[model samples]
Target: MLNIPLIGLKADQFRHPLDLEATNTLKQLPGLDLMVRQLLGQLGEQFFMLENLASSVQVGENQLPHLHQLLVEACKTLDLEVPQLYVRQHPMPNAYTFAMRGKQPFVVMHTSLIDLLTDEEVKAVIGHELGHLKCEHGVYLTLANLIVLAAGQISPLGTVLAQGLQAQMLEWLRCAEFTCDRAALLATQDPRVVASVLMKLAGGSPTLAPKLNVDAFLAQARAYDDLSSSELGQMLKQAQTAQLSHPVPVLRAREIDRWASSKDYESLLARSGSVCYDGETKTKGGWRNW
Candidate 1:
């Protein structure tokens, strides 16, 4: 294990622009951290307890060795410290990253999602989850999911608190997800791989997964982007994103599409030279200047 300190990567190195802006916006909200800490004690417990968690396949050398290898490879690429992985048996093709302020952190991937993607695509998803940990997103994401879960399972007062907290968490998460998508992009280096993962998640199964077209799906994403270019369109854009926990999938794809071509994404790779790229760090793009 490379013991190099990765904390120096900083927000500028890999965090998505929207995630950066939303995080700043969220910090301005009153008592944000207090609300987060207060709520995490309750919310954090479910992630660890057997009764609260649904079925999950924990990975190690003994189980899912292929996935274990992918996790190790992606972690090596980004210089992120590896966290434990849990593959939950869920029909939904979804995955999530978990972390607290500092105590416990891990990533969860749905079995269905694993079944839907290729090995490379799967690693991209792991990289996406790792991006959250890299950026310290586990705190807000935990609190947000908890607020929504609490609202549904508890009393009226809980509903009010959950509504307020969930809205904020959703707002933050939507952007954070995009940031992590870039992490996936960097890991896969194939925009099609990233886009296909989203498309499959939108609608896919073990049977239909093989036929999904990455190019056609990317076109769909580009078409979706065309919807927000006008004055009324811009208003709808604001309304559209204001309440969602994730950017609509197509929007996310388009964002990744845009970012994959941007100087920011290129610079990070040029400097970091991924695990597949080189051994000695060159500090390209003046990364050392940061």
Candidate 2:
């Protein structure tokens, strides 16, 4: 759980008040922590507590050694020590990280995610997952996944309670995602790269990606803005993303595109220094900074 060194490490440490407010709101809620503690074991076992790490045909040292190299390079660039990474067989393009404070951390990437993305886009995904680790989002996201899976098991009125709480969580998840996207930007030090990843995720197919246009995708994002501005647009948006886990891909693409060019993103990179993965740095000196 890295503290992100918001103040001194980067000039772009503009903590979104919404992000802070959400964190505070979560803390004030009674029993959620206790509930998570009771439930985490059941959930963590699905991935974190497995008997053996997934066998990979390749990793940083072998197989797609190129990707492994990229992962190591990204970690080095971000001043983060390399964590173990795994690729799993799955159709959906995705990645996730799991770790608790003082625990071993690791990341998983779906084969499909890699299949559809370019090497640079893949780095953005790696950086995005690293964003979770940097922001200490693993524990919460881990528990949230469990809660969603167990949503229907709460006995009577379980569905209602689950739906209500899930909506609250979805809101927080969206904003937290934004914070992590910034982390990815910080790692890559290139908004266009990050934005291009978003663009591919939005409309890229295996066959369509060779010709995918970053500018056209951005234009689509701007078009989305225009579309969402009208009266029908508001209703459409409310209907579209009301149930989504991640923010809409175009919206995320648009956001990264905008933030990439902002003074905030650049300032963070300028202030951030080169990191050596082989060396050690004090993690945090304060309380549960998350």
Candidate 3:
């Protein structure tokens, strides 16, 4: 598939309004920037980097070159510098990234996630993680992960503080996910590819992924939206997601579906230059490949 490289693409160009608003809200909170960058930044980066180096296989031209290609291509599409990629052995299908300003950034994909997704879908997952980097979301996201990991060790008063911080961080995290999903869409240039990944994450295993239907899953997302029409349903929905880090899969899928057809999406693509082709004939539209 051919993709246009969104040269000089800015996060605000495709950032979800909710993400923007929530981020602004987070910025207003006292001392978060200092706590995240000065307090947790270096320690978190070192910890994750060391762990990956010890326990995970890094993807590069000489190691897992196919996955390396996907990462490089996705970065190119998003106008991002390629970050280190690692595949770790794990039962759960998941991928995450860690980055801090002035530090080497990296992404890790659980082996099971690669098993569950097609090559294209894997690229979309990579793109999703790259979204975090593109938005410079590393600082706060690192704090959020550190909080979850250290939750059981805090003192009572510290626990209260952690809880308060966690709640706000989780809300921002959820909204940030919406923006990342948009990044995934920008990288793939195909809504179905991004939505399929979410569907698979919702309820897919290796055995079930082939049988799962993207269109049906999107319809289910619509159904979920309809379910929130009533006041009670809306309250229930809010309660369900209040403590979650990512939005419910159906809601994420629904947001991607809506945004893909929006004039804004079209306009962004129309404005972007630089095309990447998969071993196809070069065209006048600035065809390039990684």
Best by lDDT: 3
Model 3's TM-score against the true structure: 0.85
Whole-model Cα lDDT per candidate? 0.73, 0.68, 0.85
Better of 2 and 3 by lDDT: 3
Query: Which parts of model 1 are misplaced by more than 4 Å?
Result: 1-8, 25-54, 142-168, 237-241, 273-290
Candidate 1, 234-285: lDDT as tens digits = 8998887888778888888888888888998776666554222256544332
The residue-by-residue lDDT of candidate 3 on 1-290, one tens digit each, is: 55888876777788889778866665675776777887767887898889999999999999999999999889888878888999999999899998875367899999999999999899899999988888878876765656655763677776777777778778888989999999999989999999999999999999999999999999999999999989999999999999898999999999999999999999889877633357543323321211
Error of 1 at 165 (Å): 6.9
TM-score against native, each model: 0.77, 0.77, 0.85
Query: Candidate 3, which ten residues in sequence have the lowest lDDT sum?
Result: 281-290
Please provide, for model 2 over 259-280, each residue's C-alpha lDDT reduced to its tens digit, 9 standing for 90 to 100.
Answer: 8778876666554443224575
Worst 10 residues of 2 by lDDT: 3-12
Candidate 2 achieves a global lDDT of 0.68
